[model samples]
Target: MAVRDPAIDHLLELLAPLGAATARRMFGGWGVYLDGEIVVLFARGVAYAKTDALTRADFAAAGSAPFVFESRGRTVETSYWSLPEAALDSSEALRPWAQLALAAARRKPVARKARSGEDRRG
Candidate 1:
């Protein structure tokens, strides 16, 4: 099994009392799950929250940018934005942004198909 990132643990600690949050390995990086949905990623020493109006505003104020990855000579974006140190430092600063991200992420997730080949649309 792959190891969980420290940044993820810190983020999870900060986002408690809102929902179930944890880190799962995906595509050689860390994915932050809230209420069983992926809401962010801890990749390359950066804490990225889900892309949304509130989170984006906080991200901008913190002077953080989005997660831009280079792959196959092209730039790719995830449903994530950079996290600022102030947000991390302030006790309640990260919660609002986190909650918003979680709300958005809870809208999308993967579930197993039924054994009888019927789709369980969620």
Candidate 2:
């Protein structure tokens, strides 16, 4: 049997109030989703919430740092930011941040141009 990481369990518990959040193994960690939209990512024992222009400043003000990784010798910064220390206290404490994450996740994605030879028609 696979041993479940306690961190994953804890994150789910904290997110329970938000919705039926689920986690899937990914990138040597977990990707947490709510209502089919990914809102959080758990990596190296840290929980990162999705952020957008609207909420990035809030996270920054809370002293949260963005999720970063190295790829092909280049640093990649993602739109996810670590949950603030205060939010780790409980679901109630985490709710507002979680809500912001969910809102960012639910935002409409930008449209991308079709690749060469790809169908652009309906």
Candidate 3:
């Protein structure tokens, strides 16, 4: 069995007020979900909240950086932004940002395309 990270446990505890937040291994780190929707991505011990145009400015104003990574020799910036340092202190501090992330997650459009070897037409 794989060992759990204490940092992740602490993060989950801090997010308890936001509902039953859970973490799963993802992209070499972890993805934090609430209500079956992914609202945060935890990588390198940093938590990033989902963001859209509506909340991106708030994250930027907080001096939070967008999640960026190199893929296929290209740098890619994701819609996820780091949660403000203050938010890590407690659930109360993180509530507003977490809610914003949940809102952004719900606002995201779902993909309608079928993958390879799959057909949507019946």
- Which candidate would rank higher by lDDT, 1 or 3? 3
For residues 1-122, write the lDDT of model 2, one tens digit per residue: 76768988888898888789898999998999987889999898999999999999999999999999999999999999999978988999999999999999889596798899998789
Q: How far is 122's C-alpha from truth in model 3 (Å)?
A: 20
Better of 1 and 3 by TM-score: 3
Over the stretch 1-122, how does candidate 1's per-residue lDDT look in tens digits?
A: 76666677787887666678777777677887877777778778877888765356666776878888899999997668887676676539887777767776665455755788677776
Q: State the TM-score for model 1.
A: 0.73
Return the lDDT, model 3, position 53.
92
Model 3 residue runs over 4 Å out of place are 115-122
Task: Assess each prediction's global lDDT (C-alpha) against the native.
Answer: 0.74, 0.91, 0.91
lDDT of 3 by residue, 1-122 (tens): 77777878877888777788898999998898887789899998888999999999999999999999999999999999999999988989989999999999999999878899897778
Between candidates 2 and 3, which one is better according to TM-score?
A: 3
Residue 44 in candidate 3 has what lDDT?
A: 86
Q: Give all TM-scores, in the order shown.
A: 0.73, 0.88, 0.89
Clashing pairs in 2: none
